[model samples]
Target chain A: MDSTCRRMRAEILDISFSSGHGHIPTCFSVVECLYAAYEVMRHDPKRPDWAERDRFVLSKGHAALGYYAVLAQHSYFDIKEVAGFGAYNSRFGCHADRTKLPGVEASTGSLGHGIGIAVGMALGERVAGRQTKVFTLIGDGESNEGSVWEAVMVANNVGLNNLTIIYDHNKSQGRCLPVTNPGERFRSFGCEVVEVNGHNVDALKEVFARPATGVRAVIADTVKGYGCKTLVDNVNEWHRKSPDAEQLAKLLEELHAPAI
Target chain B: MRRQFKETTTALAATDPRVAVVLGDVSVYMFMDFHRANPGKFYNMGICENSLISVAAGMTATGMRPFVHTIAPFLTERSLEQIKLDCAYNQWPVNIVTCGASFDYAWDGATHHCYTDLAILRLLPNMEVLQPGSRREVDALMRATYDSGKPTYIRLSDHPHDVETNLEFGKGTVLREGKSGVTVMTAGPILPNVMAACEDLDVNLVYFHTLKPMDRALVERFRHDRILVVHDAFGLQEAINEVPGLRTWYHGLPDQFCAWYGTVHDIRARIGLDAPGIRKAVTTLLETPSA
Candidate 1:
């Protein structure tokens, strides 16, 4: 894992521990994906509502902590401000609200919605004759929704070469309704499917920067809890769990340790 | 009304570069001219109703005023979450104009019937619900609220009444005044049946096209009277009841699915929404002692 993503994993853990809110495993799954997207996206953190900037929607909205941490890294806001996650009067909620937050394009908590919105944004770009690209990240579990496939089909059929759908294939739904062979599924839906190591920020940045024909789908094969062994091994139990003081220490220790 | 939708929207699109249409493959033929003229702005984007709404919301985010059209039940009911989350909650100005209101698709069976759209959609925060009952009303309301920067729902029915209305978006019309303390309030295309039913009857008549910000001041005017909300759908009575202490009774659909397959008139006649049947309901309400 890159040093920035590892530090973000630590921030996600600290915030989740302090707030006692978040789907930590899910957040861990998409940190690098979110970081990579922002790295390539033409956006100004100061001017999130910049008219001509590229757009990103977190379709798998449960991973908002990860998104927030990554956005904080990008200077959208300070990392310390995210301590109020899921608290009253906090801009950062368990799920993102676009009206409340600066960088959030669409308020998405319900699965399978952001991708469709992203497709529409791409279409809007096409209609306006602008080259503004739109990107969205969807969970493997969220892919179970028929609306996900519905959007995938629409994006391709509309010939949205400006839209890129990043599938967080963390095997989160391996216990039930797994989206087996997501690359094949996206290809079948007429996307330019790119399979990659999700935790590798460089690899993700490469795919995001590369040109495409029609809607692009990046199948980021990822571990549910990437950097920490305890969380990685027991992903199902830690899926929506927040870490305690002692557990937070262990997780941080695991995060900073060299990869085995 | 659909023809008026094409005309009004085509005229709007001629000047307003931001005006676009996203169809769920329901009225592609009707919008052929629109598709030809504004090819980039029009999309007959397959039968996916959910995507139609979400996509329009996306378009709205980009400063485009999108009119998302489809059959009522599929567009409103099936893609309801998309409407609630993407358009309403996100506060996108998506104009959802749907056809096949209530039993307009009567021969297509209960699957095509959509009576819950207005009632359910009005509950969403910052949503505008309009049921235009004539070509004039459709043209008027669409022109007024199409780019109003609010998520608006304009339901167009094939069977529109010819009665000239207030043409205002949220205000109700006082079509008749009577000495009796009974008011027959109805909305949408069923106003003609309601008009014909109450024409000879000694009762006050009221009508509405906007159900969300329902003319509460007008409904309050009849608060002392027995307001019998006569309509073919569930929303008008609920809107009237929003004004407190008014004795309002719904003379609309029952709890059962309208299972029979036939024409809209046949279904309306059977369900006591036709001229004579509505007259009978009004007379029954008037004759019964106030409780």
Candidate 2:
């Protein structure tokens, strides 16, 4: 896993493992990509509604733990907010709620909505004569939704060079679901596909740095639980299962404290 | 009706810069002039209703007042979720204008029929539903909804209109005012049918182009009298339910898929929504004593 994003993952683990109701594995899978994307995004924490601020929506919304952690790490809220993960009046919902949270651009637990919304945001910038860029992250499983392809075709037809889509390709069909080929499919939709190691923060940063052109997509290849040994070995099997107290200790030991 | 919508959309763009249009490639020619007039504001978003709605919401978030148009079934049923979550849940003001009301494309078969648009959109808590019966009402309601700053659903029907009346949110205009304790109320192009039905009777006739904030005050007028709701849909039932005690007889398409295909008039006859059928239903309600 990218060391720069490891701390964010640790925060995510604590929130989800403690809440006992979160997508820990899915959140872990996209940490490196989100960390890299959030860093290079032209956004201001104080001015969350800044008209020209770069917009990011997690279409793979189950990975809200990681998204919330990243926002907290960016100082959108205090780190202490993570402790109240799924609390009754928490700004952070189980899925990202733009209404509740400051940094969240859209509420997106429903699999395949983010891309189209992002496309509209890109078009909004065009209409207003602003150079703001819109970015979204989707899952390998989410591409199965026809709305994703619908937006893909619209984005292609509209020539939205200011939009960027990052697919966290964890191959998460879970045996029953077919592992769809997002890279080739995206290419067919006329997106400029660039594959990167999602675990490598530097590589993700470099891929994102290449200025948005022609509705580009970054197929970040990574595993569902990259660094956590118990979760990493078995892909997505321990996804929804929150760790027990004993398991949480071992997870913290491996993720938080390096072997001195 | 489509031509009027296109003209109104162009006129709206001329006055309001925030007005933008996105269609599902269904009405290409209808928007050509608007596209030429407002370069980046009008977009033919292809035949993707889900994307069209979400994209409209996205544009709304960035301070753009976006109006989406497509077939009734495709726009309402296909993208209902997006309309609920993306537009209504977020309180983003999106103007959803749908053509092919009920079965405007009767020969196109069951796939094109949309009898439950009122029910479908009414069930969603956030949408304000409007159905324009005449050319004047269409222009008035469209302009009002665009400037209303709330998510709205407008149905454009091929039904002709002779009455010229103003529109207000949650209010109905009294077309043929009467105080015989029996009022015939309806919305959309069907208004003409109800008028034809009650043409010989000494009864009240009201038209509610807007359904959501239904003119509850109008219900007060018919508090003790019987009501003949012509296309009585969506908020009418609930509004009537609230009038303490009153008699209501509703006539519209039934709650089943239109089993056969024919002209819109034939389909209306089959479903008992034609002028004669409506008149008969109103006569029956008029005979019933208010208990």
Candidate 3:
């Protein structure tokens, strides 16, 4: 794992332990994907509402903790402020609200909604004759929603070359309905599909930098828990579980351990 | 009313440049001139109702005024969550202009019928619900609030009442004032029937185009009298009840579906919303002894 992502994982564990609120594994799954997005997107952290800036929506909003950490790393806000996440009257809720948060473009919690809104943003840019690109990240689990497919079909039919969908194929829906062969599915829907190891920020950034012919779908194959071995091994157990003091120390140690 | 919608929206698009129309393949032919005049401003975005709303909300976020037009039931009911979350909750200013109000597509069966749209949508925060009863009202209301930067749902009907109304956004008009103390309240296309029903009877008539931000002050003015909410749908009665200290009864849809296939007028007549049927209900209310 990248040292910065490892540090972000440690931060996630710390916040989860303190606030007792987080989907830890899901948050871990998209760290690099979110990081690569911010690195490649044409956004000024200081001017989030710059009319010419590119837009990104976190369709699978369960991983808002990861999103906040990445936004903080990019200087949208201080990571220290995120400790108050999910607390009463806190700007950062369990799911992000666009009005409250600085970097969030759309407030998305209900699965299958953010992608559709992202489609509109891209199409709206085309209508206005602007060069703004719109990106959205959706989970393999969220792909279970019919609205997700509906949005994909609409984006393709509308010929939105400015729209790119980052599909986090983390296989979190191993127990329920898993979206198998997502790259093939997106290809069938007329999207330019790319497969990449999601945790590799370099490969993800390369894919994000490339121009596309039509609506693009980056199938990011990832592990539910990417950094800590304990969380990776016991994914279900650590899915929504906040850590105790001992558990947090163990997770942090595992995250910082040298890889073979 | 759909023609009025196209006319008003077409006019707005000429100058505003932000006005875009997204259709669900329902009234594509009516907007042919519009599609030609403004190339990229209009899209026949297929039958995905949920995506239509989400896309419209997206367009609204991009500084364009978008109108999502389609059949009433599919646009409002099938895609309720999109409207509630993507538009209302997110505070995106998209205009939802739907046709096939109530039994407008009655021949297509119960799947096409929609009476719950206005009632359910009015409950969402930061939503504006309007059922304009005439072409004039449609034109005026669209001009008033199309770019107000609020999520607005305008339910257009094939059966406009053809009556001259107050034309205000939230204020209801007193079409007739009678000595008899009974105030017959109604909304949308049902007003013509309501008008004919109360023509001979000694009763005051009240009409509304806006459902939310409902003319509460006007509703309060008729509080002393028995307010009989007569309409072809569920929302007007619920809206009237928003004002306290008023006695209101709904004369609209029953608990079950109007299962038979017919025209909108046929269904209305069968369900006691036509002129004579409405007159019978009003006369019975007037004859009943006051409590």
Candidate 4:
């Protein structure tokens, strides 16, 4: 892994472990994709702030540690801010604040609302003659909000070709598996649905690189915890758990070592 | 009042290409002139309040000024998150025109009655809440929202009344001046009720059309030891919370869902929002001793 991606992963593990929230593992998987995109954008001087630069929105803002880590890696803001996560007077709260945080396009913690905002953003850019693509990451459970479908209908009706919505299908939100498949639900809304293994970085990169002719929905099939052995494949408990001293020690060791 | 909003919004849209109107399925009956004049700029966003505001936000981002029109309850409560995040947090210069403030939808029952809109919308930052006292005030505030380049919430009464001659944005106008034993502050259609009650008592009548960026200067000028705020909204709790100094009392509905049946007049009479009730409240306040 590159230095920036490696450092960001380590930061996510540390911050999430400190918060006693196990959902950081899910965040780590998404950060890896964001870091890869940022690295490509940084080296290319010709198209900086290019209207076509990939846009990322954390629709599931509860897992914000992952987003802050990735943003730091991209030099969007100071990396030190990640340490202030959930602190008093800190901009880095449990839910993302778009106004305070650089690279965060929308403030979201409320379910089913971000996608609608993203749809509007995408449509606005298109109408302004900008070709920028808008990507929003939604939780599987959050798809239950009626407003999400309201947004879906609008996006499709408006023909938002540059909008891409990703569902972090982690299967569990605090308790049980999602009642339905987000991919199927999105398809019913007249969107192009792509289901893939979310943890596979290369797969994520490929899916993100391919732009849709119309509004697309990507269901990233992922486990709640995909890396650490104890947390890996565990959905319910790791959705949010503060790491104890022993667990923290083991996590630090695992992150320091190379990926198996 | 609703006709004034329609006429003013249409005029604004005609002159400025950046100005657009989004109707929440109710504009078909109200905004005929706007739709006919500016077909390209007008949108029927259907019955979805959430999508309506989101679309307006998008329009604002694209350098278009958007005016969203709907019933007060649907416009303020149903899409509250959109108002907070997309409009207020982003600081978008979108105008929200809500028709039928208070118990205007008296026959539609409690669900349609909007009694808490002002109390909730005023709390949001970068939002200017205006409850126009008459059709003239509605026209003036609509023009102000267009020119001010700020987010505005305009509450319109279904029952139009005589306009306050000297209405100004951000300033409360004195309708009646007297030795201040009791000062009655009100807005929207309730301004007339307060004025009628001012005849018997040594009452000062103040019309508070602009709720946000409140007229603190005017509110501080009253020497009255007793304050009575009469509003069509959920009593006068919100108004009392905004001003300081004298002991305040509210004359509106209690903290309960509005019941089905009765006209706006009947509901106001039942909830003690009539002129007699307002005068009684003012009298009771003047008699009470300050602790």
**Which candidate would rank higher by lDDT, 1 or 2?**
1
lDDT of 4 by residue, A1-260 (tens): 44565567667777765664435656755665455444433232233334455556677777678777767666677767667678788888888786776677667777777787787677666656666777777776776677778888888876789887877776765454444767777888899998887766677778877868888887887665555555665545555776777877786676566773
Scored against the native two-chain complex, candidate 1 gets a DockQ of 0.88
List the candidate 2 regions with Cα displacement exceeding 4 Å.
Answer: A235-237, A256-260, B177-180, B232-246
Worst 10 residues of 4 chain B by lDDT: B234-243
Residues B73-185 of candidate 2 have per-residue lDDT tens digits of 89998888998888877678899998887778888887998767776777677788887777777787787778677799988877657676656656788878665688887
The lDDT of each candidate is: 0.91, 0.81, 0.92, 0.73
Model with the higher DockQ, candidate 1 or 2: 1
What proportion of the true contacts does each candidate reproduce? 0.81, 0.66, 0.81, 0.39
**Residue-by-residue lDDT tens digits, candidate 2, A1-260:** 45657878777777777777678878888988888888888999999999889889888898988888788878899867767777788777788788788989988889888888899988898888888888899988898889999998999999998888999888877566665777898999899999898888888888887886699999999888877777777655687777888888888786755531
Positional deviation of residue B138's Cα in model 4 after best superposition, in angstroms = 1.9
TM-score of 4: 0.88
lDDT of 3 by residue, B1-291 (tens): 999999999999899899999999989999999999999999999899999999999999999998899999999999999999999999998999999979998999999999999999999999999999999999999998898778999999988878889998988999999877889999898888999999989999999999987999999889989888997888889889978878877788888999789798899899899999999988888899473
What tens digits encode model 1's per-residue C-alpha lDDT throughout B1-291? 999999999999999999999998888898999989988999999899998999899999998999999999999999999999999999999999999979998999999999999999998999999998999999999989988878999999998989988998898899999887889899999988898999898899999999988899999888999888888887888888988898887788888888798989999899898999999988998888563
The alpha-carbon deviation from the true structure for residue A107 of candidate 4, after best TM-score superposition, in angstroms, is: 1.9
Provide per-model DockQ scores.
Answer: 0.88, 0.77, 0.88, 0.40
**Best-first order by lDDT:** 3, 1, 2, 4
Model 3 bad stretches (over 4 Å): none
Q: Scoring model 3 with DockQ, what do you get? A: 0.88
- Candidate 1 is graded, for docking, as high
Q: Where's the lowest-lDDT run of ten residues in candidate 3 chain A?
A: A251-260
